[model samples]
Target: MYHTWMRFFTPSPLHRRLGLVCLGVGLQHGTLPTVGPRTLDHHVAVVISAGSGWYRFPDGRRTTVTAPALLWLTPGVPHHYAPDPGTGWDEGFVDFTGPVTATYTELGHIEPDRPVVPLADAGGPRSVIGRIARAARRGNPLLEVETSAAVHELLVALRRARADTNADGDLVLEALARDACRPLTVAEHAARHGMTPAELRTAVRRGAGCSPKDYLLGIRLGRAKELLAATELPVAAVARRVGYDDPAYFSRLFTRRVGTAPVRFRAQQGRTVPGGWSTRIPDAEHPPTIITGHV
Candidate 1:
C-alpha cells in the first residue's frame, strides 16, 4: 500500500476566474478511514483509481464507491467516505474552488447531490492528477497557473470520460488547438496531421465554426490576453512566445483584433503593482514537501 499528499502555498487570480483553483491533491492506497460528516469549504473530487470504498452523505444516504469512479464533495456539503479496509482501495483526490464551478453545476456537468460518478476508464484523470503532483514536486515558477491549467484539462477530461464517446472532429480540433500555440503555419499544421490544407480547413470549420487561420489567430490572441493580464513579460517577448515573430506586426494585429494596444490592455486589466502597470506575478522560490506512506 502507498499514499502521497501535496498542498499549494499560493493561489492566483486567473486561476480563480477559471472556477477551478487547486488547493491540494492526494493519492493513497490500502485501508483508509472515513474523513468527515462536517461541511467542507471547497469542492473536492476524489477519484477511485482502483479498489472500493463507501461514501456517506449528510441526509444519512450512503453508497458504494468502486474503482475508476469520481466522487464530488461540494462546498458546504457534509460528507464522509472510507475504503473497505479488508479489500483496500487506490484513491486520488484534488481539492479546488472557483466561481465558474457554479456554471458547471448549472450545466449539469457536475451534480452536487450526486456524489459518485462512475467512470468507464480512469487513465486520463489519473494522468492529469499525476501531472499536478509532479509539477508540485518540481516547484515550477508558475505553479499556480500550471496547476490551474491542469485542473481545466481535468474538468474537460472528466466530461469526456463521462460521455464515453468521441466525435471525429474532436481529434482534429484537439490537434489544431495544441498546435496553434506554436509558430506553425496552417499548411505545416495540416501536414503534421497528415491532411491537405483544404482537408484541415474543412475539419476545423466543421468542428469550430471557423476557418483555420481564424481559429489559430483566436488561440494566439487568447493566449496573448492571458500573458498580458497575468505576466510581466514585455510585448515583444509575449508576442514571440505566442508565435508572432515581429513585435510591431503583433501589436498592429492585436490592436486590430482586440481593439486595444497590448500595454494599454494590461493597464485596463489591472496594475501589476500598487503603482505600476505590469500585472506579472513574481515567481518566488518555494520548497514544498511531499509525503509518502506505505503499509
Candidate 2:
C-alpha cells in the first residue's frame, strides 16, 4: 500500500451546513508533511485509498494506520502524521463543519484525539468518497444531494465494518436485527442457532464491538429513533413497542443513547404525536385554486 494525505475545500450551502471544506477529491501523490503539530478548525475525515502510515497526536499518543482505514479528527485536536519510511501512503481527506457534525460525534465516529478505525475492506469507503469527490468536481446543481447521500453510505459502511470482523457473526447480527422487537435472552437465541450462550456472546462482542446486552439495547434504541422520527406514537407506546414497559425507564434510555428525550426529538423534527387518534381535517369553503393555460 502507498501512503499519502490530501485535503479538499468547497463553498456551498450544503457544504456550509455540513462544515465540509472540499469536495471531489482526486488521486494524487505527495510526501507526508513534516510540519509542526497543528489543530484543525473543523472536523477532518481521512480515508486511505492506498498505503500505510504512522499517525501521532499532540498528546504523544501514536497509532500505526494501514490502508482501508479511516481516521477521524475533531476540531481543536492536535494531530500530525507521516507515511511509513519504506511504504508511502495514499489518502484523501475532507474538512467539514455543520449541524450534522454533532450526529457523527454522538455516534463516536469522530474522535477527539487521533483514532484510526480499520475498515473491513478498502473498496467500500474508497468508492463512496471517490464518487462524492467526482460529483463535487463536476459542479452540478445537485452536488449537495449526491455528496450527502455518498457520505451517508460511507457512514453505513463504517458501521458495518465492525460486524464484518467475526466469522458468521454478521449473519447472527442480521438474524437478531430481524427479530429486534421480540424479547429473547442470550441463551434462547444461542439455543435456536445450536450455539451456547457463552459462544454467542463472544461472537457478538467480536462482530458488534459490544456486549450482547449492549447490542440489544442498540437495536431497541434504533427502533426508538425511527418511531420518534416517523410516527405520532406517545413515548409510552413507543417504549412498549420497543420492549420497555415503563415509559420513564425508556425515556432515560433514549436520552442516554440518543442524546435527547423522545418528545424533544420529535419536536425538533417538526412533528407531533396527535392525541386521541383523531382523523380531523379542516373543511374549506372554497375549492383549491388551480391555474391551467395553453402554451
Candidate 2's TM-score reads 0.57
Model 1, CA-based lDDT: 0.78
The residue-by-residue lDDT of candidate 1 on 66-123, one tens digit each, is: 8878988898878888888788888888877888787767545566878888887888
**Tens digit of per-residue lDDT, candidate 2, span 226-285:** 666666768898898888888999899889878888898878863433652122221123
Candidate number achieving the greatest TM-score relative to the actual structure: 2
Error of 2 at 275 (Å): 34
Give the alpha-carbon lDDT of every model.
0.78, 0.66
Off by over 4 Å in 1: 12-19, 163-295
Model 1 worst lDDT run, 10 consecutive residues: 279-288
